[model samples]
Target: MTGRPATTTLWRPTGPEELALVRALDWRAWPPRLPEQPIFYPVLNEDYAIRIAREWNVPHSGVGFVTRFEVRSGFLSRYPVRRAGGRTILELWVPAEELPEFNAHIVGTVQVVHTFR
Candidate 1:
């Protein structure tokens, strides 16, 4: 309630090419870690993180929220969810020029998840 609104993009993937882009981005941004495999946590690559923002179904002025969970003592603990919407959760701001490319990646990823599975 004290700062300016953030910006974002919402994209829906339509083809395999787009999906491949998204997957590539995801891999680049968040390389997999064998140590963390027990929890099945997705270590999203930076590129994929951007794609997630573009693919998120929210307004341009919305804020993005990213969360990480850890299991301890046979219990799952959740990180706090940010309240702002339309904002990307990454540490750096994604350039406007890259929005289109990121959106394409997101759309492609979604398409693959929905149809190919």
Candidate 2:
């Protein structure tokens, strides 16, 4: 083994309001979901995230952002990858209550990789 820490990359498409909450956390963690939101989804591919940010988030909120982050590979294994639509539309569904544990497995600060207005 190369001896580097194992991590899996994930992408999240977010609106300005949600982005604000993430910023409030110093980019170290994602904010808890609202009462009606039962799951926190992070996509497995950047293209899927970008599509959502541009088409969904921007249209609804006037601004959208695609954030990328890494999580410990082992910790992520418990959540099976889910295909939302096409083959590339893959994501991991973390239950709302598990978000704190999920945040703890993040390998680094969340980063904005793309933005749409």
Number of the top candidate by TM-score? 2
After aligning candidate 2 to the native by TM-score, how far in Å is the CA of 112 from where it should be? Answer: 0.4
Give the Å error, residue 36, model 1: 40
Relative to the true structure, candidate 1 reaches a TM of 0.22
Q: What is candidate 2's TM-score against the reference?
A: 0.96
Summarize candidate 2's per-residue lDDT along 26-113 as a digit string, tens digits. Answer: 9999999999999999999999999999999999999999999999999999999999999999999999999999999998899999
Q: Which stretches of candidate 2 lie over 4 Å from their true place?
A: 1-4
Question: Can you list the residue pairs that collide in candidate 2?
Answer: none
Question: What's the lDDT for candidate 1?
Answer: 0.31
Candidate 1 per-residue lDDT over residues 1-117, each given as its tens digit: 665223222222223433354457662222222342322222223344435544651233243333221112111112232322344432222234433433333211232222211
Best by lDDT: 2
Provide the lowest-lDDT 10-residue window in model 1. 68-77
lDDT of model number 2: 0.96
